[model samples]
Target: MSTEYKGPLSVETRKIAKDELREDDNSRAQALRQMRDWIEKNPKIISCRTDDSFLLRFLRFKKFSVPMAQEAMERYILLRQTVKIAFHNLDHTLPKMAHLIDNGYLFAVPGRDKLGRRWIIGRPGVFDPYKFINEDMCRVHGIVYETLMEDEENQVRGFVHYADGAGVSLPYLTLFTPKEAVRIVKNGERTLPMRHKEVHVINVPSSLKYVLDWGMTLISDKIKKRVKIYTTAEEAANNLDVSMLPKEYGGTIPMSEMIESFKKELVASRQQLMDNDNMEVRLELFSVQAKEGAVSALKSGNQSCNPYKTDVLTGSFRKLEVD
Candidate 1:
């Protein structure tokens, strides 16, 4: 069976992974050494697979500050523990994950934004909240974890969650449980290793406004600031590069092809995802005080978390309607 759709669609998105680093940019090489040294010297505080690429992921997220990167890595693992989702036995081959893959509500777009952040689309088509299982959501989270592991070059600057609520029925909004909603918000907003550049909720039906507000209340003010509601696809595309987005968001590539390619990529990277299982924090090594320190490290706002201070786009979430 063919893995990718090979029509006249622009292959630009498919080729985004081949970004070249500048010759003068020795910062990463330097960061790699410092991070390794830090890990070796402080084995008690940090214990994970010492993969160079794995270490670099945290270093890049922390902007190469050795101490800060160490803290971020520890905090990430601890946060995974705190969330208590499918961190330990996250197998993509599970029945629930397979169901989610078949449904394809969420998947990362092949292309990156202008700033190099991955553009992930969440098109929860025909949402039946009664049918929206939490494990299905966890499957999405596992895919994201898989994505971060495979991003060795640190080319993924951040992420944009474009939630296409176009086809969601009103009942989904009302029926979604607060517990499930809180779990989704806490993990997706606070704990994920990458920066959340933006969240665009498009094509929101008028009847579900109250449900939307209740869901929004669960979203932290920091993340809620990034949430945007749009009446039309055109309005939503303004915040994203249309060419990078699939046809669902007024882009050129067929959504079916984009999703197929994503599935192929996921299958191709299965081994790397398994490798990541070793890299998760072994919480038993750290003392209670150490764990508290790691959690506090996450709250320090050292890396991409403080995008506004780091000179990223500065703006609060907005509600828009295009006539």
Candidate 2:
């Protein structure tokens, strides 16, 4: 297996990929070739990375399903094109981004959990919303997720997000309008090709929890089921492994060291993030398709669910099913 593939796949993870993800050398090669051919044939995809490692991220996320991989790739391209705020100027060396990193706005822990899934700790309260908008938060989140996805182990093992809402303020909650909130949730579930195993939010105040409850209504049931909330750090630690977390969270690792290590990772990935700015889609095609779809929906008298509408908050929030 080592001779056949040169990428970073450990023996244990390779077995899991084979047994669960249905990834074999032949299947991997075939999927890569098909994805590359699709990219070459698609005129709208102005530029993209077709390397085996890059392509494998999408293939593994879709469990080697070529069609699903194609769809995910398309959504990914469209996301980059439409979400300009998140994808623009993705440079880690930038002062605002650096500040966020130094303060550990969002970062992956040094080690994996017992289940082999990586834990990404997020502290949204660390950044002042006035200085850095929600878009900035999304941009930093994108950089961290993108960098982590490069690892084959993370692709197969998946990720668990642990958010500490201790210092979150009402102003922070105000940063996300209904549209922005819905878009962010939709992007994480559909557009981004990553295995989101679970989300654990601890130390959430009443105000933060209120907003989180509304935000939860926007995600798919699969994701909603995976979301868990706790009122205190001790309660959260009872469910999670303490040794893998920082001292603040009843873990051995220091938060300072974790932040420093993640900063180095961001620095290492700076070039890749800069190059990613070239990935784009021809929006005119999507614009025309959207208009046609609207006309068709009107003709058929079908009212589509628009979660972004202000009125969506007044009643039961509709659940978006995962594909």
Candidate 3:
């Protein structure tokens, strides 16, 4: 029989594997090293598979030398349970969701604050903050929502299937706004909205423009002519949406132009890598990209790249709407 498992969380949202894994620094390289050392020293929490890598997936991250995994696991459980605490302020914050430009999702912005802040405090920064169409949901006792149902409350809840072929579902908690609906009408996929006054310009990655070019055709406005591409950050600012352009096209720092800059820097970094010859620098660059992405994901009211979910549940939960 399937039992209701009010057990513990399996992973820690905050406990990342390593800030940067280095070849030389064995401690940061693998969880195996930490587990083995701790088992050798004797750990009260562990009894079996004391030095196995498979078990690493079951626990949380810890200090490199010893298995602080138990400590880390406790923290993960605490965070998962307390996620609702941060949401408690949603009612007070997002009083209206119908007109919001960015859709009120939390986003991490780099260097915006003096002390530093992430989306949910102790987490990261989130732009376009909001609560819902008519209510707040900072506490667990708040009203739950139904997707595909445009209630007067406007609280839209749904699941999004994963892109990049990852088999995962992301649940959305929010109030639907008109701006988002418009973008959906325009682009087959959702986009982050870059608003300047009354005009809404969406910033899209160049790789994604082909899809958007056609997507915007059905948008409310009939004048679907060009997906105006900007060449520089300054120019992109004028359009309110920034995207990389081919160097030949002359807009948002071109990949070819970026490659030229890379050529200059690579010559220098190449020598440094050879001198120090650390393989981790290459990996570190990849890590930086992932770390930076966390910030963009949390922004509120973003048109594209915002939380435009596409997850489908086993069966959609719907409430009847009044015309």
Scored by TM-score, the top model is 2
Compute each candidate's TM-score over C-alphas: 0.68, 0.87, 0.21
**C-alpha local distance difference test of each model:** 0.59, 0.77, 0.27
* Runs off by more than 4 Å, candidate 1: 1-26, 41-47, 81-84, 113-115, 125-132, 153-156, 167-187, 205-226, 238-240, 280-323
- Write the residue-wise lDDT of candidate 1 on 187-283 in tens digits: 5554455666688888777766655765676556787898889888888778667887887678999777877777777778776766655554567
CA shift of 123, model 1, Å: 1.9
CA RMSD of each candidate after superposition: 10.1, 5.8, 22.2
The TM-score obtained by model 3 is 0.21
Models ranked on lDDT: 2, 1, 3
Best by lDDT: 2
Q: Is candidate 2 or candidate 3 better by TM-score?
A: 2
Q: How accurate is candidate 2 locally (lDDT)?
A: 0.77
Candidate 2, RMSD to the unseen true structure:
5.8
The global Cα lDDT (0 to 1) of model 1 is: 0.59
Greater TM-score among 1 and 3 belongs to 1
